[model samples]
Target: MYATLPSPLGTLYIAASDDAILEVDFRDEAMPPCPPASPLLQAACDQLDAYFHGERQRFDLPLAPRGTPFQQEVWQALQSIPCGEHRSYRDIAALIGNPKAMRAVGMANGRNPVAIIIPCHRVIGAGGKLVGYAGGLERKVWLLQHEAGMADH
Candidate 1:
């Protein structure tokens, strides 16, 4: 099941499996915190808070995002993107041995079920403009700035 969570910045979508997290989405809704142990739901909420506060880099929680093999490969590559730098979809496509799969890379990027922790916002357009965030361009911009330490928050 999925639940929306509250944070300093905005609401977060958290989905969990019996073993781990499935997805995390940021949305414009008001919510309260959930317990952070026992139930996977609350634990996901806590991990997400750590991520947004910049206190956590790598995630230890389990994730079971449903996708095609190519999409999973793309998502894995996104996880390897260092905290502050950015990679283009083209760059990821090349790294994954699918140099011609730029759009496919983008498709995978958009389908990333776990949001911020996976760092999909770290991917940019070929020309360096921001593009392709499932969480809306504004939140994408916010995440980039937050990671860059430029967000006014």
Candidate 2:
């Protein structure tokens, strides 16, 4: 199932299975149709809305992003990065017990299927500079500033 909603960033595309969310696309040009009242899609939209409005800090919905095992590990580690906080690619590599795999960690982060709900925006360059995001750098900055209470929209 899928749904689309307008957000501060832009229109967002949300997809889900019966039991878990699959993906959230910020760059998909076409918005796919979804059932009028799919509980899963509605729930995902609600949570994301709340997040953008500063009413939510962590997501509670079930997520089932597809990736290789290594990427899965990186995504899981990303979840541990608290809202309003940031980590370097090196930090993520260390958390996954592959401290030397910073570049690999970055590759996995770049490939994250789910965007904000998975919180990949929390990762930054080692020197605290904003780096690449599947979503544009400006959107990434907005997300970070939003989490940091620095952005009102």
Candidate 3:
């Protein structure tokens, strides 16, 4: 099922299957009505709300994004990035024990189905430039700033 969640940045498109929350895409304000909710959907919404209110730093909700084994490995790598800290894509590839897979790491980060909750936003460029958010670079900047408490609004 799919749903639209009103968020501080914008309306987010949330999708869920029976086992886990699967997607959270930013909408462009022409979003349709939200689909009916499931337990997983409700849980994701609650967690996102907690994050927006600055009451949650880490998300522990169920996520089941579909992708290749390499992508899954990269997504799991993203989970270990601590709140308020950032890492380079090269750094994540090293953590996953594949220093040469940096390109693949960035691709997986872009392909991440779940957004802020899984925290692909925490990965920066080697020289610290923000890059490659499927949700848009500006929103990516906004999320990083918001989490770091450096955002204006």
Candidate 1 lowest-lDDT run of ten: 29-38
Error of 3 at 138 (Å): 0.6
Clash pairs, model 1 backbone = none
Q: What is the TM-score of each candidate against the true structure?
A: 0.86, 0.92, 0.92
- Model 3: per-residue Cα lDDT over 75-139, one tens digit each: 99999988778999999999999999999999999999998988999999989988889889899
Instruction: Arrange candidates, best TM-score first.
Output: 2, 3, 1
Model 2 RMSD in Å is 2.3
For 1-153, candidate 2 gives per-residue lDDT tens digits of 688888899888888888889999895465554542588888889889899999998999899999999999999999999889899999999999999999999999999999998899999997898999989999999999899993332
Misplaced by over 4 Å in model 3 are 150-153
Worst 10 contiguous positions by lDDT, candidate 2: 27-36
Clashes of each: 0, 0, 0
Rate residue 152 of model 2 by lDDT.
36
Off by over 4 Å in 1: 29-39, 150-153
lDDT of each: 0.81, 0.89, 0.87
TM-score of 2: 0.92
**By how many angstroms RMSD does model 1 differ from the true structure?**
2.9
Instruction: Please provide, for model 1 over 41-61, each residue's C-alpha lDDT reduced to its tens digit, 9 standing for 90 to 100.
Output: 877777777877777666777
